[model samples]
Target: MQDSDSLRGFLFDNMPIRGQIVTLTSSYQEVLKRHEYPSNIACLLGEFLAAASLLGATLKQSARIILQARGSGALKTVMAECASDNRVRGIARGDFKVCATQTGFKDLFVDAVLAITIEPLQGQRYQGIVPLEGDNLSQCLMGYFAQSEQLPTSIKLAASTQESAGILVQQLPNHAPLEQSTTDWQTINLLIKTLRAKEQLHLTHNDQLYLLFKEHHVRLFDAKDMRFQCHCSRHRTARALISLGEPEIREIYLQQELIDMQCEFCGALYSFKKPFIDALLRDQNKALR
Candidate 1:
C-alpha cells in the first residue's frame, strides 16, 4: 500500500517499545528476475526479506540482518539480507507448493526454523535460531520476541513479484523514555495484537499507526532507502574456484572443457576454461608460497 521503497520506523511516545515496517517493490522484483522461484517459496522469501529490513533498523551500529528459513521439506531454505545502509537482496531454494485456505504456523513451514543473523560492519556475526512456532512468518517472529527478547512484539509481512510489505509492533519496558504518556505495556500489546495481516498489507504506515494509537502520542521517522544489491562477482567466483584445488579444477577442465560455477545469490554463471583455470591455480600456489 506504500508508494515509496523504504523501511519506516514508528514509536508510541507513551509506549515502552518502538516498531519498524519496510516494504520492497522494485527490490523484490529484481530478485525474482534472477530465478524462477516457485510461487509459494517466493512469497515465503518475500516475507522474510521484509522482516530482515525491519530487523536491520533495530541495530545500533552498521550491521546487516539476515532472515533465513531452513526446513526439511520441499523448501530447503530461504534467506534475505538487509544491511545498515539498507541494501537488500534475497534468494529461495527448492521447489515448494502450498494449498490452504486458512493456514496455521505448522501447515506452511512444517519443520523449519527462523534464524536471525546480525553481522556488524566490523564484528563477529551473532545468530539466533528459533523454531517456526507458527504457520505464518509473523507468528514465528512474535514467538522469538516473546521468548528470546522477552519483549512483546507483533509482526505482519507479505510479498509478491509486484511488491513486499510488513508492519511490526512492540511493547517496551515501563522505564523506557518513550513512556511519558504512561500507557502500560500490556495495554499497547493488546492494541497491537488486534492488527490483522490484511489490514497491514493494505494500509499506509501513518494510517495504520494512527488507527491503533490514536489516543496516544506517536513518533514516526522518515523512511530509509531500500534496494537490491548482491556482493558477488566474477573475481569472487574465480577465487572460489581457485579454492576448490588445482587437481579438482584440472579434472573438470580435462574432461568437461569448462568449470562452471553458478552464484545462488544473483544467478550469475562463472566459467573457467583450461588455460584460465590452470593460470588461476598457478597464481594461487605462488601466493601460498
Candidate 2:
C-alpha cells in the first residue's frame, strides 16, 4: 500500500510529460475528524486535498495553493489548501442531506465554479476561475486546465473511508514539435486512462507508477511528506482580535464575558478573557499613539 501522507513526482526520460501521485491517510482523517461530513462531501474534500498537494509541488517558490468549489445545489462550498511545506487543511459547507442514491459531482454541485488560487509568501496572489462542468472532480479539473491553462492535463482521484489518493499528468511546455508532442501526449494519456480509483488507493506509489509506466523510461523522485497542520496559534488569534477594533472587542467581551474562537480548519480553541481583552485593547491604543 502507498505510504500515508506522502507525494511522489515522476518524469519521462524522453518526453516532456510529468506526473505526481499523492496518497493522504492520516492527514485526510485529521481533516475529516474536524467535522461530520457526509460520505459524498468527505470524498470531495479528500480529492481537493490531494489536488492542492499536487499543485503545491509545482510551486518553485514558497507559496500556498487553494482549491475551492462553490455551487448553487446541495453542496455550497468546499475549500482546501496546501502550503509549500506540504501542510494541508480543508473543509466543506453545504445544505446537504444524504440520499439512498449516490450523488455525482454535477448532482451535488449545480452551476458551480471551480477556483484555484496561488498565494506567494512574498509576491502578489494569482487566481483562476472556471466553470465546474463535469461528472466528477477529476473531469472538472481537466476542464479548468483546458480553459485556464491550455495545458494537456489528466487527473485521477479516489477517496475511500480510510484514505484519499490522486494522480496528475501534464505535458510540459518544451518538447518535440507539435505533431510529435501530440502523439506523445496521446500515448501518455491513454496509459493514464487505465488507472482506476481502487488501484490508486490500494497500490504503493512505486508499484502503481511501475504498473502504468514500466514500458517507458521513467524516473521517480523521493516522496515528500504531507501533513495536516493548522497554522493557527494564540499569537495569531490575538492579532486577529486586535484587528476587530476596541469597540467590537469590548462589545463581545461585555456580552459574553470573554471572546471565544475556534479554528475551523482544526479544532483548536482560543479564548480571550476580560483581562486578556483589556490588555489587547491597551496594546492597540498604545500602538495608535
Best by TM-score: 2
lDDT of 2 by residue, 181-227 (tens): 88989998888889988989989998888899888899889999999
Off by over 4 Å in 1: 97-108, 172-183, 243-246, 274-289
lDDT values, one for every candidate: 0.76, 0.87
- Count clashing residue pairs per candidate: 5, 0
Model 1: per-residue Cα lDDT over 60-166, one tens digit each: 88988888888776566789998888888898775444422313446555588889889888989898898877757877888888778665677778776567788
Indicate which candidate wins on lDDT: 2
lDDT of 1 at 77: 76
Model 2: lDDT to the true structure? 0.87
Residue 261's lDDT within candidate 2 is 83
- For every candidate in turn, the CA RMSD to the true structure comes to 3.3, 2.4
How well does each candidate superpose onto the true structure, as a TM-score?
A: 0.84, 0.90
Candidate 1 lowest-lDDT run of ten:
96-105
